[model samples]
Every structure is written in structure tokens, then in C-alpha cells.
Target: MADAAPRLLELAEHALSTPFPLRLRAWDGSEAGPSGAPVLVVRGRRALRRLMWRPGELGLARAWVAGDLDVDGDLYEALDLLSGLFWERGADGSGAGRAETLRDLAAMLRDPATYRLLRSGLALAGPGLPPPPPHEEARRRTGIAHTRRRDKAAVAHHYDVGNDFYELVLGPSMVYSCALWPEPGTTLEQAQYAKLDLVCRKLGLREGRRLLDVGCGWGSMVLHAAEHYGVQATGITLSVEQAAYARKRIADAGLADRIEIRVQDYRDVRDGPYDAISSIGMAEHVGSDRYLEYARTLHALLKPGGRLLNHQIGRRPVRDEQAYRIDEFIDRYVFPDGELAPIGATVSRLEEAGFEVRDVEALREHYARTLRAWVGNLEDRWDDAAAVTTEGRARVWRLYMAASAVSFERNRIGVNQVLAVRAEAGGGSGMPATRSAWLS
Candidate 1:
């Protein structure tokens, strides 16, 4: 009997005091907002109650995961529009930071219209207790943040979501890290190959040399290094599934003799004096508190003059580092307990661990393109992926990757390859006068 969509939009806009720029379609088929805008579809009353309970990012994430909320139009365009209002760093005046948002909420509570908004929301939500979080949400949270046990759980939550699922999303290469595109039209597989080759080159991997790949996801790095560079490689990862998958891939490629895949923690690694060590896309999981230990562990495991290529994700530094917080959705559902540091801080920590920081190359744009490609893969095979994993799990990956693409495109975060070497006692870093030797 009620046309709920228009009233819902009116209440939301009045409550936030900012215009709702997109379309909203209610469960009863009533629609609101501009004619051509992306549509936010509310499939059930549960979506509103979930948002009412948690208010910000996590609430929306839960709704989206539970399938109570969905977008009927372009996902990226909808997310880009919403990011300015709910997320973003508030630097460009399109978004508000926590302090500003809190002030705005306080101001809204004082407004008489907010009472009407609250009543409308309650009537729509029509409630029982908020629906339980989706089964796909990350659960285990017993041990210390980055301790071995907890770290394993965290890695498993994100990576052990079925290798078939990742294969569909990551393509044939199966490299989860950012790819290096030589040019715009490069295929994802080609870019990924280029990225692996670049790291091997930077570390100067050669025949008969030992290379250790810390946090080697699915064994892409080790396989590439051994096959192309003629190196004996060992790859370590916390995910059992990843290790198994990598081993199978190595066997299929006939490179098992040249590469070893182990499901072992980096701290437990004892085989030392490796000529090259690569920690690609893994350092973000090393909590800031344990970063020094991480760096030192790799340093101690490397031969003097051995190169450590830390291909990691970096975040933009803020004025007050102490107050910094990881994204709630990312912490709760995606990479649990993961943290990012500015490239400057990462380089400093490596240097403190007796590494001479050699090169810090930011590949921010490349990551945007890589993420976009991954998103395309997932979108193209959405049905098959959801069948492999739960729909909620697939949704989480889609949302995170799409948002991350926007984040990288806008420079909110970045990916960098920090090439550092354990300088020999004489202070020589293996004597490469110019990058020309490795650029090829």
C-alpha cells in the first residue's frame, strides 16, 4: 500500500543532510532518485536493520555479503559515488573524516527532521534482532594479532577460499600480487610474468643461486624464478591450500626439482645464506609491531650482499600515525589484522635491520590496472566463482577488489617494490652502478 522508495530516499537525505545521488529500489518495486543513476537494491528489510545496527562500512559490508543489498547498475560507478560520502579521507572536500562525521551526526541528532527519519527507518526495518552475519565472514580471533597461530588463521581466511575460486579470479598466472604492465594493452598474464621477471632481475637471481620467497602465495614467484632464471627456489606460505596448489602447479610444470613449496611460517625458516629473498605482497600482513622482527628475520636468513625484494602494499602516511586504523571491512572480512605503512617507514625498518635500501619503486598505477583486470575476471565468471565458494565470499572479493582499484587509481594507497641488499662488510652492494643492467 506504500510507495516506500521515495520516502526512504527522503529520510536518508534528510538524515545525512547530503543529497543521495543514486537510485534506490525498495523490496516492493518502488524506485526513487534520478532516472539514469545507478540503483541500490534493497532485497529485504534486513538490510536496513543491519545498517541501523552498525551504521558505517561494516554494516554495509554485512548487508552486501548477506545479499540483502545489491547494485542494479554499474558497481564501480555506484561505489565511487558512495565512497565520497561514507569513506574517503575527506581531503578533497567530497568526504568527511571520523571527526567531521561525528560532528555531523551530532548535528543531525539535534535536528527535528532526524526524529522522523528514525521513525521511517524503524518502520521499514520492521524488526527482530539484526540478522546474523553471513557464514562466510571471518571468525577465528583467539591469539595475539600477528602470532603464528593467528597469522595462519588470517591467511587461511583470505587465501584458502578454494583454489578453483582464485584460479577463476586470478587467471592462468595465479599471481595475486600486482602485475607490471609494460604498456596499457598488455594481457594480465603477460603483465604478471613481467612482474615476476622484474623481481627476479632486481634481486639478480641466476643459475645455481638460492632464492627464498617469503609468503609465496600459490608459488607463482618460485616457479617463475626457477623456470626462467635457472635458480633453485623455495617458497613459503602460511596457507596450506596455497602450498598444496603451488606444489601441484610445480609438478605440472616439471619444475618440482628446481622449486620447493612449503607451508611454513617465515620466522621458522632456518635455511640461511640465500642469495635472494622476495616477500611479494606479503609484508602487509606483518603487523606494524612485528615489522622490525620480520625485516630482521629475512636479513638474518640472507647472505651478505644478498638482495631482498619486498614487493608490498603501502598506505599514505598521515599527520598522526598513532591514530591510524586499518579499514574495518578489510580487518573483519578480508585480510584480518593486516596493516600498511608508508614506504618511508618500510625503508627505514629495512635499513635498521642492516639492509642497505637500494630502490623504492612505486607501482601505484599498475596495481589499479591489475585490480581492474581481476575484477573483470570475477565479474565475467561470477556464477562459477560463487559455486566454487559461497556467494558471500565471492561478493567480498568483488567489493574489495573494485574499491581497491578506485583507491589505487586515486592514490589513496599504493604498491611498491623496495629492493634492499644486505651490504657486505666492505659496504659494497654487489656493485651495480646503474639500473640499466637489470631494466631489461
Candidate 2:
């Protein structure tokens, strides 16, 4: 039984042409590898079989979601170690997505050890058919990308993962985007409030103004703006669950008179000429091909001189931008059809859409901290969260959030707020002359 771990590690190292970085603990309670390294607990051969058949991000994701694979120590340390091999692959070629992508199968076909490797890997995974994907796994969508119907499905898959589950994870604030941490001692709720207020300030929300929040999650932004800034706020989301949850929250907050929550897609938004617009943590779902359209839509919807604040997650720009592929695990298990663009391209697109890009603030570290807090909340209430959402779904969020936190920490990715405005035809931008007003 103890040989199980060593054999699996040796096979993995040989096949991948690299050292197996994490310690391995096999099903029979066998353990091997560096004594102090983060331990990857393989509960059974099914996890190995999943990895063997899928050979990449999806395989790893399937195993994790199904509970066949798990981490025994600090998740960040384990994922950070694998980040170079299977985590953040960019133009530097750090080997992301799949082990097969890194492995030279053609070379292996010519290698005499290939047959022995295959046989050993097969025997190790044991006798079994490939495991079916977990029920929580999203069904892959078909047809043209970013169609309103497809977008709605995508949103439903991600955001409709039950409001209670989100509440357990996101805390009472329900502000899913990056928080604006003013100080180290700031609580998550406080940071979230600061973030909403910051967006309101940047957009210059005021009494009697009409504000639109695109992809508003659970009504936090609209409620805050309407209550604090006295604006007539409208929040639109494709998720029926989100809309319902947000509407109820707004009613409870006694802001229903000022805020309107609608299950509406951004493209279908007919009401326009808003004084200000906030698209927080939403544009990632707007697919790269539709991003310019998204920008144009926001520009067209806003009044002249009206500001638009877009807070979105961003990836590092690779030398060959066209080569970018959405991570398979994220696409399948998490944000299906979601895409992240470099912030520079995001600014360029907004400017191309007739808006003067006024400011770009990177809240990368803020998001990292926010995710850690959310992960803590989830970990603290793991049973409650898992009860509302399946264990598989909970596992997905855990890995996603923890890995994202590390990604932000290592600068592999970031979240940024791009503030822009539709300049008046006479070129009056209506923005304050100095950054002090906004920064303050």
C-alpha cells in the first residue's frame, strides 16, 4: 500500500517530464514524497483515472469536484507550487491547461519507455470505466457565442448557484466584485461599502440622477447608490435568482421605491441616457468578441458627460494575444463562456467606443484580500455552504477562490476599475480637474 504513492509519483514525473512537486497520499493511507510538502490526498484510483483520461484542467477539476482528490495542507501553497506547471501559463510557457499539452506525446510514441509508462499508469488507475462528470458540472453550450439566450444560460449557470450559498460565501455585503480596502483593519462589509461608495463617487451619483447597474448581483450597488446618493437606480441581471434575491433585499432595505431590479440582459436594455452607469464585476461575462459591443452599448446608454465605471478581472497580456484560451476548468465548472482581457485592451476598447478614459485603478491586491476573506467565510461555514450547494459546487468555489487569491498575489491576474465618460460634443468632459476628488 505504501508503494502506491511512490509509484504514482514516479509515473507522473516520467510522463510529464518534470518532478511531481506535491506530496501524495494514496487511498490505502500510503504516503510519499518530500516530507513537509503540501500533501495531495488521493482517496481512490478514480481520481487518478480521471486525471489519466482527461489529462488536464478538466480532469483535475472533475476529480476535485467529485471529492476523489483533495488537499491536506495549505491550499495556496499547493496551488502556488503547481502554478508554474499547471496554473498560470502565459507567453512564458509555464505549462497551463493540461499535462498532455506539456507532454510530447509524439516523442513519447518514439520512446521505448512509452509502453511501460502506459501500462503502469493503466494498472495504477485500476479497473474501472471513466467516471461521469459531476452533476454540478455545467452543460457545454452550443451555437453562436454571446447571444442573449446563451448569455442568460451562462449567467444562470454561474450566478444561480443558489443565493443562500452565495450568502454563506460572500458574507452579508453580497458585493461580489473586488472590495476597496481603505485600511488593514477594515472588515469585508466595510470594504465592500467603500467599494460601492467609490464607484458612486467616480460616477458622480447624485439626487434625482438615473443610475444603471449592469449585471448587478443581489442589488447591493443599486441599493447603496439609491439610498446613500439619492439616485433612481436600476439594476439589471440575467440571473432570475439574482434578480429575485436582489429585489427582496431592496424591499427589506426600504429602497425598493428608489431601486428597480430586473432580470434583463444588457443587450436588451432599452432605457438609456442614464446619468451614470456601473458595470461591476460583470464585463468578464461579455466575451471578448462582444466586449466592444458592450462598451458601445454602455456609451450609447449613458447621457452625454455621464460616467461609466467598469470593474472587471483582467489577465496578463501575452505577446500573442490571439493565442489566449480560457482555462478549461473555469469554462466548464465555473464561469462558462466567461473571458478576461488585459486592462490596456479594455481601456482601448472603451476609448474606441467614444468615451474618454479618465482613470484606471488596479485593485489587484484588494481582490486578492477580498477572495481570502470570502474563502475564510466559506471555510468557516463549510458544512452550511456545502449543504446549500452540493459538495462538488462548494469544492469548485474553494479551489477557484483560493487559486484566484494566489493568482492575484503573484500578479498572474488582476482586477481593475476603468472609469470613463462620454465627453460632451463641445469636449466638456465634466470631470474634476484633479484626481484628488476621486481619490479622496
TM-score leader: 2
Q: In candidate 1, where is summed lDDT lowest over 10 consecutive residues?
A: 90-99
Model 1 CA RMSD to the hidden true structure, in angstroms: 2.3
Q: What's model 1's lDDT at 263?
A: 89
TM-score of each: 0.95, 0.96
Q: What are the per-residue Cα lDDT tens digits for candidate 2 across 1-440?
A: 36788888877777666788899999878888888999999999999889777877788899999999999999999999887676535544343434654345566667677767767778989998889999888896899989999988988999998999999999999989899999989999999999999999988888999999999999999989998999999999999999999989988888878999988888889988899999999999998899899999999999899999999999888866766768888899889899999898999999999999999899999999999999999999999999998988999999999999999999989999999999997988988888887555
Model 1 TM-score, all chains together: 0.95
Q: Assess the local accuracy of residue 23 in candidate 1 as a C-alpha lDDT between 0 and 100.
A: 97
Candidate 1, residues 1-440, lDDT tens digits: the string is: 65789888987676555888789999999999989999999898899889777777778899999999999999888888887666544333333454244236566577777766777788888978978888878895875799999999899999988999999999999999999999878999999999999998899988999999999999899999988889999999999999999999999999988999888999999989899999999999999999999999999999988999999999887766776766778988899999989899999999999999878899999999999999999999999999999899999999999999988887888999999999888999984878886555
C-alpha-based local distance difference test score of model 2: 0.88
Give the Å shift of residue 313 in candidate 1: 1.0
lDDT for each of the candidates? 0.88, 0.88
